[model samples]
Target chain A: MNSPLITRFIFLFVFLSLINAQDKNGYFSLENRLKFGNFLFCKGDYIRAIDEYNFVLTKQNNDTLKFKIALAYQKLERYDESENSFKELFTSQQFGSEAKFEYFKTLYLSDKFETMHKRIADDSFIESSISDKLKRLYNLKHLYSSKSIEDSSKFFQPFNQNESIELLKFYVRKQNLDNKSPALAAVLSAIIPGLGKVYTENYGDGITAFLLTGVLTFLAIDNFNADHNFRGWLFTTLAAYFYAGNIYGSAASAVLFNANVRMNFDSDLTLFLNKNNHFSSNSNLFCK
Target chain B: MKKYIYILILFFCSVSFSNDELARQYEYADKLFNDQNYFEAITEFKRLSFFDEKNVYAYESNYKIGIAYKYGGFYDNSVFYLSHAIRTTENIDERIQAEFQIVRCNILRKTTDRALQLLSQMEKDSVYSNHQNEIHYWKGWSYMISDRWDSAAESFANISDDHELKILSEQVSNDKYSVTFARVISYILPGAGQFYTGNYLSGLMSLAWNVLWGYLTINSFIENRAFDGVAIGSLLWLRFYRGNIQNAEKLAVQKNIEIANTALLYLMENYRGEKP
Candidate 1:
């Protein structure tokens, strides 16, 4: 009985030693691979790093190892694969706040702007480490970049009264910033030709129209005096209508131009403040 | 010694369990493919393919994967996987299916010349005789895309006077109406062709507007309001007169489109016909 018990003890000792050796070997290999992967990632050898990380993932058992594998995939620009890995890490219990932040960054870098905006909107994604000012700035940038002007206005409206006003003005200015609405101005001018120039806010254009109409009237009168009655009558009628139309058009165009200018000025100021981190950061700081 | 034996047995059991699980997964994927859940089916098939690299069903699995992509509107992926299936499979039936599917994928991708070449090659082969009807149908569609109306009509006519295909042939043939006649009728009388095409309300509206403008200009001229006459005659009367002729031709063309679309929809939904 004593001999049997001693043999059992010896067997148990050998079994324990074998298990320890296997664990050590597995962990050492995983660590070495991870180190190499990090080096490759820093060198911008993303493809090789991805391969190494994938190898580690297949051989290692740790959840943390899995998260690093996903990060390496992101560095390789294998966005779809990286998103999958990060999503898995997010679902698992092994990741902490740092992992969560990196996961959000991965999502943002992937141009998944809409998803990132929603994530930031939810307070659960914001921890004590990330400043609220930075969060607001990110949200604003996403608001401007991902959404249409009309959509951005709606999104920015909830931030603050002054910010909303500023954004609205910027969008208005950006609308006609390129000055490509000449055809629209032309149509308005045709309705009263100098009127179009006034609509586009060219005051000199209104004066030019008045002078052209006057000269044509004078030519018609002079031609009629010289007995070119048909040509005179044609010029006179065209000159009469154009002169009246120009006056009407100029007034209408002036109002439209002023409105457009005011809208653009408001927008420009808001965009400038938003870009320089003046509005959102200061507002967030005050709120805190 | 007993403990060591138990440990070895445990490892063997785990490996066998994994193999069994993989087999089960493959079976599940096959069922999904049969059910036409191609997107999800491809995912499961890929997973099984990864785990069991030497699976005898790999050829069938890859073939089905391609078919699933084809049915799911992913033509490029379908072509890629179907080519893989063709290269890998020894099964004659699957090979024929893959070849036909590659042609079908090319057609959907708008690579008509490639599809035509494949169809032409298949037509010369005795083994592909059973696929003639499908090939003809695709050829007709190709002709339609290239706007070769006569050839499209001929292709559709070659199909057996089966009820569905006969209707499609009739639709293609009926679209050959004279646009010149439609334009002539509109020029002779504003909105007459629109009325002929069963658009009485639009025809009457066009006639009323044109007649009103024509009358106003003539009346202004009679009253010696020359300026008013000239302005209304050039801007309003001429615009409406031109618009009436153009509208008449447009109405005829629009009616033709409606007729063709109705027939096409019927063919797609109700016909128990062979598909391309």
Candidate 2:
């Protein structure tokens, strides 16, 4: 009887120890997974971090984890998923305003300036704390979009004095872009062998065209004077080919020059926005 | 007697749950790595490193992470993690393994100088003196990737006279056209460079065009039309001459590419050996 009792007690004690071990190392427990997910998030491994965070979501709802998942989606450049995730937090007491700000930012980053502008203008869910900053972002978005902007006074009101001065240069460059006209370039080259290329700022090509056409025309005249009819006609034909090709080339060069100017202005505007933190006071809002 | 029996029973029961958390984590990470889920595997390995407070899994974790990065095409990151493994491991074999992995990564990254530098350093170290064959092997790879066929041949010849890579390198060195020679010969004779590079048709066309234009230019000057001579000489004769030189240089480069490509294709298909 005593032996059986001792055996029963030992089995119970061993079972309790196993339970304790499980408790100590619940590797996939919600708390442990959350901790691991946070580690991955901090390390910029957003994809796997989202996996771990979503794993925890299967067990329970957590606002902080949801916000992190949205931020991770944003970092991964999955704009649709990021927008949807942020939309889910729009009514949350803690992250509602922050979600609104980040959602608009995602819209801007995704190049949906029209949508961002419309949402900022019409959405009643805007928070007072971020209202000025959002409006400033709205003004900045105008620089990137093809949409016409408001007057300089209204636009400058959103930025500080120093920023206004710098942005004014970009704004003026945007307004006074030296876009060449292809038709004008063609006519100029037709009137003068290479003037259209000169108008398009291709000085070397212009000079070459002028020299080649001038030399070929002189050869045609010289051959004709010497009674070399075949040679004269050959030079005339070559000169005609070069002259017509130059006219067409000048037109094409004008179009390319305009494209280059637009590209440079867009790039400069983008760089300025990036260098100035996109004129956002809350650039680091949710990142911290 | 009952007390001793009770103790034995408890010991047996406890032993069933003896695997700790860190060990289980290590096994899980190893499973991920073996399954080739490197993106997730890196995370799991990092998790193990984080929880392993006593640094027990430092060497293994870094090594696995480095290998994972290598497979992922992140050679710089692979070198970084392998360097960590080298620092943490006390074993000479493990150190050599990590160091060679760094060399392999550098080779694949096309940083041949760093790879050669590290390999030579290892060759000078007494601990790696016995690994000269392996060093020479990777050195050959570095030279091969840098397109230094002669150096590659010499490096692989250090391993054995009949080494396959050595043979391939030597074949490439002999069969490839010399760009400078082609250019100089074309400068001397209108299409000789093209003939040397085996572009017979281009060579003949170049020679014909140059001769026709040259005769026209000289005849114009002989006929007392100075302007005609200058126009023909500058516009047609010189253009063909310059084109011949350019074509020769281009053909030589293309021929060498074809030769190197043949060797590369053979290596890819039939060479039964490790590659970078």
RMSD to the hidden true structure, all candidates: 12.7, 4.2
User: TM-score: which candidate is best?
Assistant: 2
- Tens-place lDDT digits, model 1, residues B1-276: 876775565555555545565567678898998888876687667655544545656777777888888888888878888898888878778888889889878877778788888888888998888878777877776665444545666777777655345456556656645557767887888888777777899889888988987887787678665655666576567888888878878877787666666655765688675544
Docking class of 2: acceptable
Clashing pairs in 2: none
Instruction: Quantify all predictions' global Cα lDDT against the true fold.
Output: 0.66, 0.86
Question: Clashes in each model (backbone N, CA, C under 3 Å)?
Answer: 9, 0
Question: What TM-score goes with each of the models?
Answer: 0.53, 0.88
Q: Write the per-residue lDDT of candidate 2 for residues A143-173, one digit (tens) a residue.
A: 7765456587888886889888988998877
Write out the backbone clash pairs for model 1.
A169-A267, A170-A267, A173-A264, A189-A193, A192-A245, A195-A249, A195-A250, A198-A253, A199-A253
Which runs of model 2 end up more than 4 angstroms from their true locations? A1-24, A146-150, A281-288, B1-19
